[model samples]
Target: MPEKTIPILPCRTLQPVLDFYTALGFEVTYQQRSPNPYAVVERGGIELQFFAMKQYEPAVSISTCYVLTDDVDGLYQAFRAGLKETYGRIPTRGLPRVGPLKDMTYGVRQFLVTDPGGNCVRVGQRTGGERHHGPAPQETFARALHFASLLADSKGDPAGAAKVVDRALALTDETPTRVQLLQLLVLRADAAARLGDEEAAVTGLARAAALHLTAAERDQGRDALTRLADLRGSLRP
Candidate 1:
């Protein structure tokens, strides 16, 4: 009367897959290399298994899974600390990277994590509040932020996300809110850095840092501020 499904993804090799999850505080439960290379990792209530495939390429991998966490922010911090300690930095691009937490237009607070095998583990926690039903934000920049976040973070297309943010900046006639401007600039910085445009990233981060915010705005944008700091850290040697 019950069902539990564990994803079995393909990896170019088992050690990398194991090491990546291990760095994220996952414990190795089962592993084998003699007959067929396979390994399983577990953290809290989540579990993932991997099998080796010699011809597999992580760049083109399309495998993914969804994981719901009750303590999304706390879990994120743990993963962040572990990854930084293990790899010396929290990777923001390419395979085996962790994404910043975001509140989506669809009423979810989530982040994307790609393992060494390119299997994206989308981890999220439903935010507090009653669901509000209404048409999407009509303003250009607000709309662009939604679309750009999906493209850049969810779909892993930094170049496309950068284009969306640029178009919004050029076309928006209405002035954006302080938080809106901050989010847009931070997202721009992320897209730029991932695309290997360090100058643009620096400019965006500086602009975001320069914006004035009241107590309310600062409290409201606490998460974005945290993400902004992460982006800035990424540029450091």
Candidate 2:
């Protein structure tokens, strides 16, 4: 199965969004012109698709999608400089509902800006050098499931990580994608072990190990399980 693409925002205008992303140094990885044109802009492991929507209003939506960048300041600076060089003003600030940059308490330096058509876009930089992007998902469920791992690792908050995994499990409960579901289970188990929740760790690891984790993923999970087992084992003898 091919990896799933994350939907960025439902867009009515393609040219402006395309131009905006292009100006931000994002390259188009995929583009289709028919039946509802769209484009996927990607950099590093980040992939986001802009879908053409006939409705131009900003509907209440959970995620227009998130962009994790290693160089938040540099990207912001670059965009600021590009705007100055092109239009003599920052294109971001002029947008409606946009605000000055603010440092988030979660250690993520980020800012929000509205697109030309009122879609909210967030650009975040994970603090403490933690990676926010992970392997691609084979489906939407898997993508969301994998996102839990990234969120946990990115924030360095074990509780937050566990919550994301639980959310993913709940969301994927009815029709779970094996790869992602198992991966998330393992991640949650790891988080549980980190928090010294022995019972939860054992249950999570047992469930994950029962699933046929991919060779590489299995190794990762096994390593994590081993560490947890060792920790628990030490207290026994």
Candidate 2's displacement at residue 86, Å, is: 3.0
In model 1, which range of ten residues has the least summed lDDT? 128-137
lDDT of 1 at 168: 74
lDDT of 1: 0.86
CA shift at 142, candidate 1, in angstroms? 1.7
Error of 1 at 70 (Å): 1.4
* Model 1 C-alpha lDDT per residue in residues 39-103, reported as the tens digit of each score: 88999889999999899999899999988888888888988888889888878776788888888
- Candidates in order have lDDT scores of 0.86, 0.59
Write the residue-wise lDDT of candidate 2 on 1-237 in tens digits.
887657566777677776666665678888888987888887666666788877665434333456678777666666555544554444422232222243443557665555554566678787755444334666655665445545544433567878867766776336665655565676676567657686887788678657765677655444344333433332232
TM-score of model 2 (CA atoms): 0.46
